[model samples]
Target: MKSGDMFEAEPGSANRQEINPLLKLALELGPLMIFFFANARGERIAAAFPFLQDLGGPLFLATAAFMVATAIALAVSWVMTRKLPIMPLVSGAVVLVFGGLTLWLQDETFIKVKPTIVNGLFAAILLGGLLFGRSLLAYVFDSAFRLTAEGWKKLTLAWGVFFVFLAILNEIIWRNFSTDFWVAFKVWGIMPITFIFTLAMVPIITRHNLGDDSPQDP
Candidate 1:
């Protein structure tokens, strides 16, 4: 749901190749960084380009950049892996559609609320999977780590609820505050919060780890 939801190559079964961690990180975060920078320097950017002024405003400009960056990222992923990672692909598709609407309608609101839609979509997916007795989180994360079935269920629930919370938070911030403030929060705030939350999950991960005690490569 979040931009940080970087995908790994499919689970090793046959000839699938692994993606380099650094490359994956770049593909995941680079577009977001570009968007944030474009947003912060939008006036200067518009002044230089002039064409961007016709796009409506700084947020719109950033949205356009975000769309392009997302497409590039997905393309690079496909080139490196010869396959699209489902999660990132889904996120990228949302970016393209919502970003297109924002540009077409000249309404910043559509782009501003993109995260809310993304997070909510992920929450629904996870919860819907649970209803069907499937642990979709395990599918998304199985390549990264191993976990017991119960562990997968718990993790899926936690992540689903967290995603709902993020959707709500995005709605609150974007609707109630200035675009600059929202952009700053997206760039400076969300990643750190997500990183901290991930770190906090180490205990849960350890508790649910479904493997031998011997050290293994991540």
Candidate 2:
């Protein structure tokens, strides 16, 4: 029922080093915060820097900073663990690609749609893994709790569907709203929604936990 036992059961997890929960969260959220900040203060930032004035506008400036921050986060993770976390790595790749296009073409549309692409990709990956009988969510949550096989399947299914919903929500918001509103929502709205959804899963996790005191169905 321990984390070690869960890792041993998962392929390629035996040697995985557990990242500190707070550090992991900071690494993930840090780049996002920078993105939001850069967007909100893009004009002021560009005025101060003078050199960044050529980047066009707030969204483009945010995209540039986001790409840089994501690379730094990945590099820090690699240096500390000698292995890149799968989900972050995938998201970082998308950021670099779409961010690059946004900058190169001077089009904010690419950057605006980046979340839809990333979320849709995650949803596809999770759902596809389920089709192949793999509960890949275990990779992300293994350090948090140990769950029964059925528990993992259910949790993974829930997350996969949630990702799909996020992708759609992102498309709706970005397409119908102003750029500033979208930037604020991406930072303020999405993270809180995800945090609430994670909290809501406590009952499911408690029911299927492999702890000694957890109840089992008859």
Candidate 3:
């Protein structure tokens, strides 16, 4: 495994079989959906089944459910694809850690701050790699694109700074807003922003595309 060799699995190998992008997106999103739904239905479900309520506040129960759902979703993804996504794996670890703190300390702050911490970690790793003259985003994205090295480098830097911005935004939201508001924002707010930002990258991706290997230009 060379430092710059980002492809963990060779194409067409058992581990590198092309994953349906939608399914991949679902895996990424399933847990957050569970969290949001669980929170929305928390009081009702807790009333119907009181034991679930004792888990703590609606957010706490939701955090616990989110953790369980994240684990289940990851397991199913492994069962279906037999390959783990590196970035999500990193996020999952943070979920467990911060989620545990939320439960153990019986406070919502840890869970509320989890995204900021994880995003910061991502920003640090990606930017630090750039400073070292390496582009690590190539690993997680290799399954999706085949950009020229320069393209990978530039996109990597862009994502790195973008992640830092997201971290700052998370901090601002959680610090100033209510727990309910923050959770709502975490689930609903980030997705569209991320989608729009990703779309904004299309031009850059087009410019650096590997021609026939690139996504069909619109």
Candidate 4:
């Protein structure tokens, strides 16, 4: 249940190192806040630092900052824990690729659809893991909490389906809305929705809890 056990404690182990929950939350959300801020003020930023103009428009500049922020977040996580968290690693990879394409092509669409791609990939991975009897969510959630095999399976299924729904929702939002609106939604809307969804899972977690109760990494 303690933050210190986040990375160090295994299900059966007692020893743990201090890892601040606030720091962990900051690392996860910092890059996203950077992205939102950059996009909101991208024009002024480009004007102040003309070199950023080379990256293209506001969206392109924002994409560049996002890529850098994601890299820094990942690096900090590695330095702190000596191992990359699986979900963030995967999300960061998608950010770099899609961010690269957005900058390179001077197109905002790539950046907009990055969420769709990432969520869709997660959906596929979780579902595929089920087909293979792997329960891969265990790898991501294991250090945070322990669950029965049935609990893991049900949780994985729920998350996989939720991811698919998010993917579809993202596609709908981006394809039908303005760039600014989409940016706002990505930063303000999606994050809160995901948080609420995670909170909603507490009862499910409690139903199949296995006693370990370290905080989950989002």
Best TM-score goes to which candidate? 2
In Å, residue 138's CA in model 4 sits off its true spot by: 2.5
| lDDT score for candidate 2 against the true structure | 0.87
Q: Is candidate 2 or candidate 3 better by lDDT?
A: 2
- Could you say which candidate leads in lDDT? 2
Instruction: Estimate, for each residue in 1-218, the C-alpha lDDT of model 4 and write its tens digit.
Output: 45443443432334433346788788888988999999999999999999888888778888899999999998888778765666778899999999998887888888999999999999999999899986778766665667887788888988999999999999999999999999999989998999999998888888987774543331
Local lDDT at 202 for model 4: 84
RMSD of each: 4.9, 4.9, 4.1, 5.3
Model 4's alpha-carbon lDDT is 0.82
What would the per-residue lDDT of candidate 2 be over residues 1-218, giving only the tens digit for each residue? 45433322342345777669999989999999999999999999999999998988988999999999999999888777767788888899999999999999998999989999999999999899999988888878877777887888899899999999999999999999998999999999999999999999998899888875543221
> Which sequence of candidate numbers ranks them by lDDT, best first?
2, 4, 1, 3
Tens digits of per-residue lDDT for model 3, 24-143: 888889999989988888888788889887788788889999999888877876677666666787889999999999988998989988999999999898889888877778766666
Cα error of candidate 4 at position 42, Å:
0.8
Clashing pairs counted in every model: 0, 0, 0, 0
Candidate 1's residue-wise lDDT over 1-218, tens digit each?
44433444333334445578778889989999999999888999999999789887788889999999999999998778666777677789899999999999988888888999989999999889899987778656665777777777888888899889889999999999998999999878899988887787778788988785533222
Alpha carbon lDDT at 116, candidate 3: 91
Q: Tell me how many residue pairs clash in candidate 3.
A: 0
